[model samples]
Target: MSAIDNLPPLREVIATHQLSARKSLGQNFLLDLNLTAKIARQAGDLAACDVLEIGPGPGGLTRGLLSEGARKVVAIEKDTRCIAALQDIAAAYPGRLQIINGDALEIDPLQHLTPPVRIAANLPYNVGTELLVRWLTPPDWPPFWQSLTLMFQREVAERIVAQPGGKAYGRLAILAQWRCEARIAMSLPPEAFTPPPKVSSAVVHLTALPEPRYPADAATLSRVVAAAFNQRRKMLRASLKGMAPDIEDRLIAAGIKPTDRAEQISLEGFCALARELRRP
Candidate 1:
């Protein structure tokens, strides 16, 4: 069956399966087949990788990925009603789609997929940041997945690719930029999604670094970033007050201006500060 012919329109499938968007699950189904197809292409060549797609409500992106020549796709859907709809895609593709019914957070995509894995998803709004942080801060070096082609609220996307001293620059920017080469590939207005999310959305493509930009522990780095940005309105010396009395000294030692606000510092500067804090 052709990509268009094989899967029913997402709306019909959702209704037939009685799949209503559950707010608690962060569900906002993507109904436009053409839009999903465009997103699938953004992942580059899916023919070479096992695609990891999270929250594929109604399987719109799933169908697109399969049609785009995916070697295989492991779709993790938390909604049971959506699972049956995805089962149809699995049957249509035969061996190319595997629908796992659970949260993507609990399942490690790398363990389930081999090398050359790439995550392509119209992620659930709430967990998108959490999931991206997990991928960007994998405990092991030379992290899994060749790249990530994932969607986020436009504001969130700004945070991912936001530059030093930019208004959007903060913890997310630091963590994402520190470990990956990132760029915002495309943007979508609120109308792009079914039921239309209040905010616009954007797709971000992040390829992992060979190693993080600096020598530091991911956990410690995240903590330092979080503390510094939690009170971004203040200078680093004041914002990181809860961390230690020497926080100002450490910031200066790391070559970051002690008086600079969190948004003013670069990702490398954050890493350098984390290293300083990591020492006894």
Candidate 2:
């Protein structure tokens, strides 16, 4: 039995099932139950929340979520090889663990879960940022999940929580901080995973705000942010010239200098600019 639960240890389960992490799938199995539990705890008060987990290889973190009293855990895994192993975990918890064999990118998690939902996962490295951006930019405000506790490469994690004027800060920082409260919950070394990744990883926790911290049309804001940062070093006048015929006038009206670079603009500043561009 595993130290934390009645289920077998992750290593034993992997060996028994002959489950090997696949580079193509961006899999790096977390074999340490202690660390998994720590990641679970970072989600905060899972007893009342339904959690959506992506890429639960060998169910290590799945077990942690179950043991910590999550109301329900709906795990999405693309690898069919891991299903039977996850089934063992479902049997152990009975009615609490729901395993879905599918690609996370293609699946809509909200369709399967109720409100007061929280997403916690050691996300697949390849699609991690794409997933986060999807969650952040959903058409609707106050997204389905109450919060997100996700793991990412340390570099990616830094970008998620990065502030303006920092080297890591850019489009990601603006998007993440504009709509949610994002922070790095904890850091893990390269050695933390079963097959140590070349770079370290970190857990980022983001709580959704009731409304965007500043108001601007979501699509407009996204386009404006994307355009500005697409040429990070260019003055806004040069980069955003295609966005509007009178882009310089819009920048002036928004109380922004057309000569300013993307990295120098704050979230609210960007919102102001987007609002100006959005005007008829």
What TM-score do all the candidates reach, one by one?
Answer: 0.92, 0.98
In candidate 1, stretches whose alpha carbon ends up further than 4 angstroms from where it belongs are 1-5, 242-244
Q: Where is model 2 poorest over a 10-residue stretch in terms of lDDT?
A: 107-116
Best prediction by TM-score:
2
C-alpha lDDT of candidate 1 relative to the true structure: 0.85
lDDT values, one for every candidate:
0.85, 0.93
- Candidate 1: deviation at residue 167, Å? 2.6
Tens-digit per-residue lDDT, 1-114, candidate 2: 667898888999999999999999999999999889989999999998899999998999999998999999999999999999999999989899999999999998777897
Residue 41 in model 2: lDDT: 96
On a 0 to 100 scale, what is the lDDT of residue 93 in model 1? 94
Model 2 deviation from the true structure expressed as Cα RMSD, one decimal place? 0.9
- Number of the top candidate by lDDT? 2
